[model samples]
Target: MTTYLPPEVQAGLDDARKRALKKSQRLSVQAGEETFRVLEAWDDGFALELAVADHLRGMVDLYDGPTLLSQCLIVASEEDGDQMRFEYKRMTEATGEQPVDFEKPENAPVALIGKG
Candidate 1:
């Protein structure tokens, strides 16, 4: 059966959905001793803007779960009632291994001829 909701009812439903999304979709970032809930997140970093809080500056480290993401610098922060927006760039390269040490010699490859 095709049923239609009233315009008012539909609008209310949409508003509810939006709120639910915000409630569920949030991350956290460590700012000084306190951790602020991330209102929005991205590949580079997360964002938190509010009037009352310890000012975030310099390098802001973002994390996903317990894993730390690339460090980001506070490239931009506007003070509007302490309103600040930080745009960041990934600092560390994605390479799994640590930066190569030119001073260290390469280990000779071992042959496993007999062992499976």
Candidate 2:
């Protein structure tokens, strides 16, 4: 069965969609064995993205791989208008290994892996 959203809810979704499209930016990350790409980031603190398939399995293959799953987070700075920063992190996992840490530190090298 298909149920429709309430009018108010639909309106809210529409507004969010407009805002997201206006300020959307792409982001990518390499965590453990898999890479992640963030499709969009808006002025608001919401990120629309997806994780690479087989990421967890690839990590398991690595001896020193991160046990936690990797994700892409959006960081926005008004000072750098229209430019959103991509932050990477690993969430807690069932395994015992520590999660991979993600941060934006000065002097971190920025490179383009390839064309999306």
Candidate 3:
């Protein structure tokens, strides 16, 4: 069963879908000098439109807007009509933030215990 929508209505739906996709896809991937939007991501992998995935491989950087998130070596994992998934052969965090180890002596605050 199929319902026909007027051309204008169909166009409006298409526009809305595009806007939603743009809003939801907050991350981007950089391969060499080119960049592509990441449609979705997880700890091990991410997806991109098949057209974009075609040009990418090996080492790439993932970014959240202008901030670098991680560097990965990605290989194709799956593909469907319009999208492809990539699994990380390797991934490393690119963020400046480091995990805190409060127990580490170097991380402890410096103080003169008797002077205080």
Q: What is each predicted model's overall lDDT from 0 to 1?
A: 0.58, 0.40, 0.83
lDDT comparing candidate 3 with the true structure: 0.83
Candidate 2 per-residue lDDT, tens place, 73-109, comes to: 3333222222333332323224555556886679877
Model 1 pairs in collision: none
Q: Write the per-residue lDDT of candidate 1 for residues 1-116, one digit (tens) a residue.
A: 86899999988986685456447654556656776656566565445655433367666556655666555666654443323456674455333567865756478555557766
Residue-wise C-alpha lDDT for candidate 3, range 1-116, written one tens digit per residue = 88999999988996686467668988999998889888778889988888657657899999999989888999988885567888999999885767877657766677656755
Clashing pairs in 3: none
Tell me, by TM-score, which candidate is best: 3
- 101, model 1: CA deviation in Å? 1.9
* Candidate scoring better on lDDT of 1 and 2: 1
- Give the poorly placed runs of model 3, Cα more than 4 Å off: 1-19, 97-116
Question: Residue 67 in model 3: shift from native, Å?
Answer: 0.5
| RMSD each, Å | 7.6, 16.7, 4.7
Ranking by TM-score: 3, 1, 2
